[model samples]
Target: MTQEPAEVFAAFRHAESLVARRRPLDALVALAPVLAAEPDAPSVHLLAGRAYLNSAQLLRAEDAFRRVLELDPSDHYARFALGKTLQRQSRLTEAQTQLRMAVAMNPLPEYQEALGEVSARIAVEGGR
Candidate 1:
């Protein structure tokens, strides 16, 4: 049986709250049904990316964010998230590329900050 849109969204909201609470496993559980029903939804993918990131599921998070970017390259948040995921995985060069793109697209303070961090890391690693 197909679930109602409202129900799916409600679950999504619940998952979002769980993520905010640092309960990523719970968030993933909350998201599962909606994910199954709407695998291609950008919102679902974004939330899943966030949950996976918080849960330290780095590869899964990267895939989720990459899917979002593939669907909507103009999504600055997705770019930022993907950059952060790469950073967590110690892929500084890839992280910097994404962060620079995100900064050029939107110039959010957070995006700039992340870029600066990655740049600083690169400089340090180069000096070493």
Candidate 2:
């Protein structure tokens, strides 16, 4: 079913609020129609990715984050989110690469901290 742009925007905002309130599952439900309506919107995908990540749906989170990057390569937040999803899945090397790019692009303290964490994990695991 097709939806009006205003409706999609409203759903997106509602979904964003749900995610912020820690109701990720609810956010995902609210996002479904928005995703269907605006599959190419980086903001929508980023919001879905955050919901997925919050809900521990790591693979889906990774996919959503990847989609955001595909739409806009310079999205440092997407890179950081992808890194975090990979890190949670124990894919430290891949996570490290994404985190490095994120930090390089924006140098946010959170990005730096996440990169440091993944790097430390890799170092510890490599020493084994």
Candidate 3:
């Protein structure tokens, strides 16, 4: 099933809206065709990664974020997202690494907060 570019674009937008609305399952459904149609689109993967992360599909979110990184290593948001996903999965060290990189790439408050969180967690766990 080949989707026209316009259809793919519309679907991608719709999926993005769904993700924003906190409807990750619905967003993933809407994104399926777009993902198939635009496998190389880093934005699409980033959106899907966000949807997956919101839905608590940590491993899938990790994979999606990794894909975005592979496509666009300079995407600081993707690194932040991947860090969050790893943090959720209890991979604190890996999460800290990603969040540190994200903060280095772009020092957004949210990224800094995330990095601080993972650092605190690692520190706490290490103290145990």
Scored by CA lDDT, what does every candidate get? 0.94, 0.95, 0.93
Candidate 1 residue 32 Cα shift, in angstroms, is 0.6
- Candidate 1 lands at a TM-score of 0.95
Model 3 TM-score on a 0 to 1 scale: 0.96
What is the lDDT for 36 in model 2? Answer: 96
RMSD of each: 1.7, 1.4, 1.4
TM-score of each: 0.95, 0.97, 0.96
True-structure lDDT of candidate 1: 0.94
Q: Write the per-residue lDDT of candidate 3 for residues 1-128, one digit (tens) a residue.
A: 78899999999999989988899999999999999989999999999999989989899999999999999999999999999998888899999999999999999999999999889989889512
Candidate 3 Cα outliers beyond 4 Å, as residue runs: none
Compose the digit string of candidate 1's lDDT tens values, residues 61-122. 99999999988889999999999999988899999999999999999999999999999999
Candidate 2 on 23-98: residue-level lDDT in tens?
9999999999999998899999999999999999999999999999999999999999999999999999999999
> Which portions of model 1 miss their true places by more than 4 Å?
none
Which sequence of candidate numbers ranks them by lDDT, best first?
A: 2, 1, 3
The better candidate by lDDT, 2 or 3, is 2
After best superposition, candidate 2 residue 127: deviation in angstroms? 9.3
